[model samples]
Target: VMRANYRKILVPITEEAKKLKIFKGEPLDLNEVSNLNTIVEIRKLIKNNQAKIEYLVENKAKKKQAAIYLLTKTKVEYQEILKGLRKTAKKQQALLDNIVKKYHEYPKFGSKIVSELDVSSSVLRTAVKKGWLVKKEQEIYRDPLKDFESRKQKNQIKLNSEQTHALNSIGKSIQKKEAKTFLLEGITGSGKTEVYLHAISIALEQKRNALMLVPEISLTPQMVKQVKERFGDNVAVLHSGLSEGEKYDEWRRIRRGEAQVVVGARSAIFAPLKNIGLIVIDEEHESSYKQNDTPRYHARDVALLRSKFHKCPVVLGSATPSLASRARAQKGRYELLLLTKRANQKSLPKVDLIDLKTVEFTGAQFDLSIPLVDAIKEKIAKKEQVILLLNRRGFASFMLCRNCGFVLKCPNCDISLTLHKDTQQMQCHYCGHKEPIPRKCPKCQSEKIRFLGTGTQKVQEELEKLLPEAKILRMDVDTTRRKGSYKKILDGFGDHKADILLGTQMIAKGLDFPNVTLVGVINADTALSLPDFNSAEKTFDLLTQVSGRAGRAEKTGRVMIQTYNP
Candidate 1:
């Protein structure tokens, strides 16, 4: 399973070689010699019978060589940390609370948090003196959920009959301590998340941990909140948005068994959690679960492996299961549980597709059709909101010189640089290379350069022009680049602060806002044009997910999908 093997060449100092000052080899740590080329050379020598170096698989903590070390509160140090509890100054107490929170969050390293706590060194010094916190020279785990406020104990929610049945099936596997795979296929708004939460409760009740994998960045915060709210501070979240310190602490929490529940993105499947009672891959159909890089491994596949190793239950839950998983469930390899109806008994939204070839354009922009504009205006008039998904960001997909027909492209990558109006730069979506937007073509020096191809930013601009009174909140990679921007934008829309919410694919899934009565897909053909075989499946999933976000409350939802191909 190892991708590369590194070995250190060590030779005892010999009088002849030492006196000559030409030693053949020196004592070195194995980790310090991580060169693949050196390993290949040694392998060749061994194959030729020219060398007889022994291979040793050293079993140690995976992160012992890491730069930061964890400082944990000793068992008897709890009271010491809380010394002079009431008499402590308000500011000092707050800083102390922060330190205590970190202690509970994970084995927080002494070096990372002390300087940043906005407290004097004496506070940390006092804790050390009282044996309240001990600095140990060991690698620490990164915790992304470190900043999450610790919550009070929450009561377990009651499950409906369907959720009970699913939990019962999962519970049986946990009770038997046998490896089993389950496919929990449910429609949108079917309370699949409820089933997952209850199953996790069962796993923890049995004194075993659980690992849950979400699909994308959009799902992480929403799901993490739910899991954390249910499991309290014992839950660790792993995702890409987390800073290095946060990730390290969360990882260490799982590794050391400090965290009982793990909720994260695709890479969370590899968390060093032992004796896991349950593994869940939420939104199992998402392509994001499949790693696109080397040592490529699907989260589903890894879940199955860990389930087998730990003799636990692995649940794959999705409104639309992938074809491969559905086939497996069909063949009885995985036990399938179905939730066909909405948990709230609300009717599904009405879906209407606008054919661009036949529909009349609303304005000179030629992007938002007349019917879509009218729908948005109607929603705004009713005090409801709208979500517009363009599946593309930036002001335009490319810049073209009208005179010479020269197109602007990224020098480092083959893809064209997207014109970002907000940043006033031509940015490469793939490589992140950016330069000032060009007025004249770099190649032909043509003055008439045109921004071609519509994007979320362009659609947002058009919406503002068409509906001048509508308040719009744009959520995309460009708009929500900051750490907490996703939640901020979603919260604003939910609070009726924004009448129109527009964005790329990130806004398409796992968003629930009842006031969002109308969902307009400015262009639905983006994913369909991909060369991938499952492009249709992806497009279908996206449209279905985004459409589901409309009118989830008492109001009936309406979706208008604008497509060129019908």
Candidate 2:
């Protein structure tokens, strides 16, 4: 008697939206956003006599669960698909529109007893369901769940409604894109990584391989750790950091199908992984993606083209996503998923810029901003680590003739020669031209000479004089040119063995440190004041990233940026 009021209904949703979200035997709005029009359409279908909910089911066998909500019942079947399924299934079916749905999970099997006089009952009773029961079990197909680690592996990911919808839709569109290209542009700290991981899992389940790329080597270890932790041994690492033999072995493993996924810096785009189903690029807008050497190519652009060649999709992730990616998403060239929240217990650091223009440090032979010195001392007293970021290296920028005001210049190139007090030599940073310290100026033979401008080495020396007990480590090509020197330096700072970490542009990408509370920008103006169009952007990203290093976990953190322009 209650089934009489359960008149069948149908709802309207975008065809594209429907094609990706719905699954077989799945309720309407399964993965789609519910709307007023959808509700009204369903309600109208329930109110009309022309609509029959039972006819919505293509097969009477699968319609047994249709009894829960009559309003959502429709004459349409779930046409969305997963990999290797038809690109899109748009054929309409409203014949079994009278059926209602069942809300209970794991319904009990019932006998086919129905009253002969009831038309609907008689129709359902004679449908003769033929599937879902095991007829002949095969022993070879049976296996213990403990045999595979994946069977016991935990599902750590918790997706929001939008992410769930995206997964369902993306699964359905895989087979449809034999000729189509798709991109995912998500913002900073956004769970963009999870989305890509979800997609990669699907690709692997389909017996295909995947690829991922990041911009900087500094960020690779963190990513590699995450991927390896998630995917296990099936993952391989590749990048300039690896030995040639190691890279070649990884490439071979990729081509032979031994490794299903490879993650690395820009060059990994050419990893030669076959049957590629997905490609993910983290920090897609980074300039590091562009190859500066000959046969130059942009990693992101190349990844897109490679994905096209393989008929796969690309997932591009960034906290501060690049303008190009944003533009593509705006133009509908890529699907945009916004994960505005940080992954775990983390927060963006507070940035405090100390203007150096007004601070008087000129009392000495050469001036260092007083606010910066104070901040350093304050951080030291508080027992929190500090990082002094500068973009230049060398003891001093140049040597000068105080008597004649003549500056020393490089002989080979028309550039100033930097003074290296540690070695008592004047060297051209560009051409490597070096000469012993002269008693008199080369030009006017004046004996009065002064070293001009501070560099990384000078900063290290000054900090020693100011904070004698502080452990200082400098990281740059100059100090880390040896094989494992970079790793040694990073280890020292990472373990809190070093109280102060100072360097050129090497340490700014995304070094996660928990104890770093004070990030001091020795000279923010160095990069911004450089003669380059992208200087501002590079400086901004670097500054923001460095500041992020402070106060990452629980303990409060602050940043002191001392710049001439503040």
Candidate 3:
């Protein structure tokens, strides 16, 4: 005997069952029954009445359909169709006119037309029925890299002896289907990327796929642009910066074996592209490769695992190799390839350290020193560009009251709330908590409030005041919160629209601007002050990578590091 509905039992005439609204000879949904004891008692009565039990089925999520409807204009005469339609049917007429005007010669997206014109599906169906329009349902990928223009012709870059040797060594592994790992330790401006591109081409030539992972989303644009220019539509990019639809579409493309080359940030290591002939992890030393959240996986380790599964070679390229990767090479577990000279045969930028404790500052904030300001002026006068790395965002690090020594902090994380002048809000970086900037100190109600510490926004304000004519572009998490903002900022800087590109750590690496002749590190001690064990290593990596952004072209580059500790 099995449990039965309380109402389904004929002999359920007890006081408790009546209190629960259970009636005899009435089918009751067990879900609506509240009291467990009453339900059990009613089930016992039903079991004595020869009732049987049935188990409920759990619902499963349905698979998402990737196909979408596509609309195109047919050869039917639009004027005749409009003439046949009643003049009162203005919506249908307008949609027909738009389809003829915009999509007469080519296929147009049906959803785009519907949203843009606010036309309903009924109108489209009527038009399709009239034979004035054609509808075809097909799976289409939402291209995230659509903004990047493809190169009409792929220019063959002449690789130097070092680059050629590295490519050849990687090529041998690809040819032999050996799951080998190689440590490509090259200087910042050495043609490591070029070597990666050539090796990707070799893998494609073998009718196999390839994956390239960058450390940051900021770097993805430049790398994607280069790869797209080389491989065109065959390239797919995956990163958090893309919208969910874009990521899903790109993922679908990779899974369907449409994209031959997949480039993205750390999470892209899981792209389902079978027959991977090569895997390249750029900036291998970057700590960003390790995911801090659940299912914490490092991309470098995943790349090695994928290489083993596909029997392909893995390339770990970095200017400053992590100690673990370097040690592995030393232990003969991974082959080490060195590229000492710059790819363009140019000299490394001359790095000068400014003693912030001794040198006079250009502004009251003491963020930019006299030498740095003067060098910036010189570069602006020469019509060159400058990249200023502050490594922090917002206007101020924290708000402090001089009278009461009170500091505003996030309630959730207990971290100082950063003052963002643009939004006029105090925001916590770790937990995303935001509050309006207080007029006075919350603790003491003192009017004597001061914002301390420098950020990219404050330095940008200073730069504008110092170099009035300099066109500045600020790139941080605040400015780049919108979609396609990274490409916009980088493209604007690349086109020489901005003389100074001010940003945080995101701007520190994987950027190549030939016109950028000078790079200024507003404060070099920020990273070194961290209590972490690898803070010093992170500091060195930041300095080395950011310094590489300057003088990449014919002009010699210069870097000034302002550090009070130095």
Clash pairs, candidate 3, are none
lDDT per residue for candidate 2 within 218-302, as digits (tens), equals 5666666567768877888777766444555566667778789898888889887888888888766578899888989998878
Across 1-566, the per-residue lDDT of candidate 1 in tens digits comes to 11234554433233443332222454334455567976665455456554444444543324433323245555346546568677746645765666566555645555555566666656666656655555456644544565455457665566768878888999999889889999999888778999999889889999999999988887777788788888887898887777655666677777889999998899889888988999998889998889988989888888898899999999999888889999999999999999877777788899999999998998777798899898888888989888889888888899988888888888899788999898899999998999999877898887889888988888888878888999999888877778777777776787788898888888877777767788889889999998999999999989988888887778889999999888
Query: Candidate 1 at residue 410, lDDT?
Result: 88
Assess each prediction's global lDDT (C-alpha) against the native.
0.80, 0.65, 0.87
For residue 61, give model 2's deviation from the true position in Å. Answer: 63
TM-score of 1: 0.77
lDDT of 3 by residue, 1-566 (tens): 01232332233344454444455445455566679886686678666653443445432322233323345435356656767888899889888677567654346667776787898878877777876667776555666887898777788899999999999999999999999999999998998999999999999999999999999999999999999988888999999998766777787789999899999999899998999999999999999999999999999998999999999999999999998999999999999999999999999999999998898877778788889999999999999999999888999999999998999999999999999999989999998999999999999899999999978889999888988999999999999999989999999999999999999999999899999999999999988888999999899999999999999989999999999887
TM-scores for the candidates: 0.77, 0.65, 0.82
Q: Evaluated with TM-score, which candidate comes out highest?
A: 3
Off by over 4 Å in 1: 1-143, 146-157
TM-score of structure candidate 3:
0.82
